[model samples]
Target: MTTTPAPTPDSTVAEWDHVVVGGGSAGALVAARLAARDSGTVLLLEAGPDQPVPRDRAHPLADAGRLVLAGFNWDYRANLRSSGRLEDLLKGGDGTGNPARALWERFPYQLGKVVGGGSAVNGAIALRGLPRDFAAWAEQGNPDWSWDKVLPFYKAIENDVDHPDHPRHGDGGPLPIRRTPRDRVHALDAAFWGECTRQGVTDLPDLNSGEEAGVGPIPGNTVEGERIDAATAFLSDARDLPHLHVRPGVRVTRVLFDPKDRSRAVGVETERDGRLDTVRARHVILAAGAVGTPVVLQRSGVGDAALLGALGIDPVVDLPGVGRDLVDHPSVVIWSRPADGVCTPGLPWRQVAARMSSGFDDDVDVQMGLLNNVESHTIPGFVDRLGWPLVVGMSVMLLRPRSRGRVFLDSADPLASPVIELGLGTDPEDVERLCHGVRRAWGFLRSPGLSARLTRTQFWSDRMVANDGVLRSGVRHIMNPGWHAAGSCRMGPDSDPYAVADQEGRVHGTENLRIADASLFPVIPSAPTNLTTLMLAEKLARSMKE
Candidate 1:
């Protein structure tokens, strides 16, 4: 896809009605919709290169096998070690019996640097957050985000090919949603589902149709093996709009304010090709993802006054919650050896998954994905020594975690990546719930159907699963982020002390400035956040026009 070149540095005096920072999933759609409505001239800026999206051949963004392609990611690292208990558990003395410190060290965070953000690089699972998930947001002072109110926006973002007629699924929208046919389901995934069924896990044909608890083929935003992400969905046609300008490789540093009126945002300062420039706008919207948005806000002096003061930044807005309350699904995976001939040709890597409530009385709080392969250095060397083409892994994720973390600036420089400390296992309940999920996954691996197709013994030894203390240790050791980060710039009412943005996405203390991305989530969703991020943009863009 082609876009207009960015305006020259001196062109900062040329005013745009709306300037959007970050050409990610949310920002791309927001700019497209606003421009389409003739509301204003919209300028979308991205720090990464405008990657070539070719329909004729396979591309990394288009192929699930090349999910995390090199050179297209922001390459952020997160410190997951949060508590003293965790430190004690992971600390090694003389390096004798305990797993190496590297195993429990920092995790690599995958934030998309390209135009489509995560939608360009993610696994493309088109699942929605549970209705209860939105209800909780409403309860947190964002009544506009209630499930009933946001359902229309969700419908407006997708054209579901598999269940277009279903009341909950949409038929006409920019993105296409489809699921793998039962006959074409990967052999390993099919076995997983069968095992789940025997253990009373519901056999769900459609996981996104009102009911979320069950095992089924995942609905993805893929058509004919190519990705139709936000850029491909919204900006592809909107690029023709004379008012819309999607400029890649322009890195926005901070929102600019009127000199006299500190509360009013007038524009933003950006860096491109080692040249610093300013771009004036009547309104500035921050759709940078959870990590990028908070970094921009804090850098612009919109975070805790004390923190900003320490960094020598004059405070623009003293919103202490700007980078607080970071949330994500804590996850772990158990690798198993596949039986002979199980890794057949044409078998998909990950096409089926399960969401279970497990021991919890609440909504489905646990997610399980069947992975045919995972070539990560994080895994044990013994597994790699087996010499199989791919090792089977059952990943379990805690959907609703009570633990919270932070995203803060390591330096005032816009080019510097922020320090992300995911306080995983900070809350004992999170660890306890994850342990329960792990035990359930262990049972699934041992079930007749899966055992017949793979070795019952997993990389996480039977001895570890047998002892409660050992199981808890294993849970802490193997836990990883779900790659669904949110709540860094949460939305809520003025009454909420931690609310950075109100229900309309307006930054609490700044005029003509708003945020539309995963950062606006008061709480992280139970499912993959890509679809929800698009829905948020569709809703926020319309609200901005009104």
Candidate 2:
């Protein structure tokens, strides 16, 4: 059993039983689960405002609808490898010769700023990764992380409004998920899936039924048209708990480890309204996501020993893998010309996705999401950022890749955006794999079911789609991430050189500290990270209690 240290005579720092950093998607789960038990007090801290201001009082900066281009993002940049510096944006360069080059010399990699993290602003597509995806993690030395081991957590977390009667689905859960009725969903989305069936893919009416390796309508984490984000679903109950305390607009600058017991994490140093404060806790769980979690570790001297020495910070744990092995689903948008029909304004959360095994025969390694909006070709909605009035589009994505990127310090400042080297398309296999999906996407749009409804795209010239070689180059050039980022603080056996955490999500060489966010993923799941992230939080919470 673990012993609780006695308080010192002059101890004046605020203390809690557990201090959970970040209030994003994963953070909400941590806080909610901890506060539910009759355990000691739990404290949650968020970098953004905590209040759920009604839409009427929301400013443009704080607005949830416009999450991509708005100020509610930590816009990190992925620089070109040619210059290999963040300064490449000042003097722009053209395309890279190899598929191993940067998609954009300097493109904005946006991360959520609001309390619910990506869930508050994301497309709301709820998907679980393939079972094979989790099985791979078990092979990688995390046995408990196997798909079978964690399937119960996945089932328990969802309160499926559509498949509530399904044996695999749960009836009592905070996160409400619903399958869109056929009449409510857009025709274009329906046609795309219909064409997939014509192309030899069996129509998967319910993709989340543990057999999701086919084309289907995407389910969403929405309750009656409103988003049931992590904060909305989990934090509401947490807010009512007397033992739970939430502090918003508070940024953690550095983690506080015990000086005598260097491996023991005690609390964190935070800045709120420019006022510095020290809050101590018996345990600390960093759910600050893939990007934010590693930053905290590095800043607290748990990262690369040489880098910390250079930064004038004393090394605590000297773990070299603090911010390494970053992974994301690199995507490229395929736009068809304005269709014969006009896309109705303010449609419901429009999302449709498909999973296919590009390399393997059975297991899915590639997934594609089709969009019906102008701006996000990333996360589409009624909002339009592009000048093009009408278009049918799809986000072709390489779900799993051999490429690995990194998150390093831009400066010593805590508030600064970390230098995110989005190492996408770094491997030659990634390009070829994505190129094949792009060709498939083009072919699907050209099918009679899809092509009959659309005009040709104005964006693509003959040169861009001339042949396979040309399309491969185009895929490499236009590829971007699907905003599902993970694997910065990788989890594995401690023997792994790159592992930042053990199989139980505990940081190496430290006690009373664990990571429960996407950062702990050794590799990103083959689905939208929202559901997996919540399940991860539940796993960590239950494991710690046990």
Candidate 3:
């Protein structure tokens, strides 16, 4: 276990009007807004280092890799459980070798432990939820969370490139949204869009207009040629606020509640500098992402009584849904070499035009620029060298997956990694849908524009493409998660017995305690989750002000 420095006398006992538990995407936004609202003092506590961009992880694109290698990111692991006997599987048993299965069985769900949390090291894709998504929330019992009510908040945080005249989009919102310029688009990306149009798919000019059915270039969280990570956008400038206090490197052990009331979360107990210190707060908001939030809840005695008792924890709240209903987008990559000279795979004109015309099929919801050079460190031995580059590839992700997973306590020890039960593809439809997505990718590659510039590579090995079963397996092998975890502390009406918070992000049964992060998302939207998360934070801030 990594030890944090002891809190000095000046830091140990301080009172605040609102205490924000995280400094990442949602937490930062909430803190900034709360402070700006003239709400009394607010304290932001982060478990990672104080530095914005740690020295070890210098490059912006390489931060994810650094977090994975170093233990800066929450390296959550899990045990595998069979979909056939999920209950029995949870009881502890051997797991199948499927990556998702292994995720449930062997590895703990990893979350970034730094100040910016996962936002500092994410693929910066910014997408808003579809109208149908919010309507579905109302249908599911969250009436106040309908699209009509939420659209204003969504618009309040976004500044779209195409529609500058819209009054809804705020020019001064902390989050930045911009179109990927044509000069930056790769040649293969242009071909992909061209093929989609040729196939007769309707092109969507803007996916963020709350209509997310068609295809277009994925919008990113970038501004002024630099990635606007949550830490940089929300926390850096606001740090000087006299009302805001930020404590880095402090690991919150558990939330402290009044034993008599049980509903009131009075404060939090944390270990700093090898010593235990308790800080009191009238309001406590948990923004520890899907994995960390539940863990904190369970540790603080707010979960299934039986499970808590088994782990020797006294139950404060018997919320069975504390660690259930997890969802994530799984993706696969298709690689091809272009016959022409190296594709200038940055933001380019051909790529922008293609993105503008990319909606050819209903199946492919969002299309990102597939670069010629693979710059990911997750894939072993593949590096993007400006010269002598021979391989090019595009990653195709399933926009909406039917798979559901969970995060649970592996042991009573709060320090041990939690057990993540990712039941991916257990639903036969999920597997079939992914297979269909791969076929769609094949169609896009065969488009005249792309085909004119590229040569085909084997699906896995040259021999595997001929066999349908092999092709399916290859797709599965190449696919990995795009992160974007949500739904652990889901928000909704009382009908959802497991939901931890209400529409305003206020934790159920608690007066001042609320959850202001991704953990409150009841359903993972069809688009990328980062922007939606920021929107939620903005909405939460407004609700708090009112």
Candidate 4:
């Protein structure tokens, strides 16, 4: 056992029934649910900007027309490309540095730093993974988390405007949902889907409703064009609750444990306005997300003991799983030019998605979609060549990537960004899977529908797409670490070596300490994690009530 010092709080004024460490998707729900019960006080802390993103019509970035470059996003100028193949390729007189690679080459990890976190800036493509995703989680010793068990929570939080009458949906929920109109869909996207249909892929009406494996317009969480972020959806009503207090612009440095028993976490040490303070609570819910949560745990000496000892902090729980098993979709993009006369449509076009199998097996592991807001300025030396207002592109993500990475401390400073290694394309199969998706994307552009509206054709380069080996190499060269991430503090049964928390969201070896965020997910979901993260909060809220 190592000796650790319990944090000395300046005052007890920050005490509450529950203290939530983030103001993102999961954190918002934690404060909202606990404060709604009229039993105890709740306090939420967000290290980012205090004010919410204005949903006013004048806010252009927040408009439905373009990608949200909200001020609250944290650009961790960190590199995600584990393999330096892309840089070497470019250095060797390569002119085609595609936007996906060039733009994200140095600064890859774009994380939400505002009250609602990712929901404030994401494309709002709310979706859930296949039933197999949750079943896999259950198989990893996390029981009661199968799709059937978690479906009710998904229903409880979503207010699907298009599917109010649908059996699996809820009537009145916090987040508003609207399916992108098929007629309003971008012409290129419509044609791409049309081509997919001609090729025998079925039409999935709603992937969020758990029906997967087809092409359809995705649902965005919006009400009258304004994003319905986690802060606006759940934390709105909680603000009126007298017992709830949300403190923004405060960063949590480390978890505070009870002096008598270090195994019991009771509060946290925080930094705000250049001052250190303490916030005590009966129960502490770390909702700082996958990247953020592990940093807190490791700083508090909750990770591997040897690592903590090196940093002059004693271990609270010798769980080596705190920063292990980091997972995310290793993705790539394919850019194409539209036929000369077709003026670009204005709306952000991450509006639809297609799920298909990458290999010979029938199971769906690849997700292909048409993105409209392709930033061509970041394209290679030939940016002057592909001249258009907005470019059309095909982006692909491997749903079940076998490649796993890690998250760990940089210098034991909570303010420091966690060093994230997105071990993408390390697995040979992942490279092949992405290559398959690329081939499919090439096919889509060459199809009769898109072919008529696009330039004869173009790959990142002629050499890149020449053959299978080169294609896979090109994939490794331009792989994106993915915008979303998960699995830093994975939850599982005690018997598992990487089990940081148990099924109930309770961190192992600690009392009154639980995790309620994407950090608890053992693996990244097949779908965008926004909806699933909310579902996790709903389920955890219900579990606490029980």
Name the top TM-score candidate. 1
Q: Residues 262-290, candidate 3: write the lDDT tens digits.
A: 88998988877778888788788888788
lDDT of 2 at 192: 78
Residue-level lDDT for 15 in candidate 2: 71
Order by TM-score, highest first: 1, 4, 2, 3
Give the top-scoring candidate (lDDT). 1
Error of 1 at 369 (Å): 2.5
lDDT score, candidate 2: 0.74
Q: After superposition, how far is residue 101 of candidate 4 from its true place, in Å?
A: 16
Local accuracy of candidate 2 as per-residue lDDT tens digits, 370-411: 667443343432235455565567767777778887776645
- Global lDDT of each model? 0.81, 0.74, 0.66, 0.76
Best of the two (1, 2) by lDDT: 1
lDDT of 3 at 114: 76
lDDT of 4 by residue, 1-546 (tens): 121122233324545777889998999887899878754777789988755433455653255544455467776654454433323332542323344544333654678888888777676777876788998998998878998988888888988888887788875888888887889877778887898898878898787767668998887787656667888788877787766778788999999999999988889999987899887777899999888898899898898776666556778889889977778888887767766655355455677789987653666888888877555553322244645555677788889888877777646655776666677777888888888888777777767877787773445655566587888778887777556678888889989988899987999999999999998998788988888999998899778756
The TM-score measured for candidate 2 stands at: 0.89
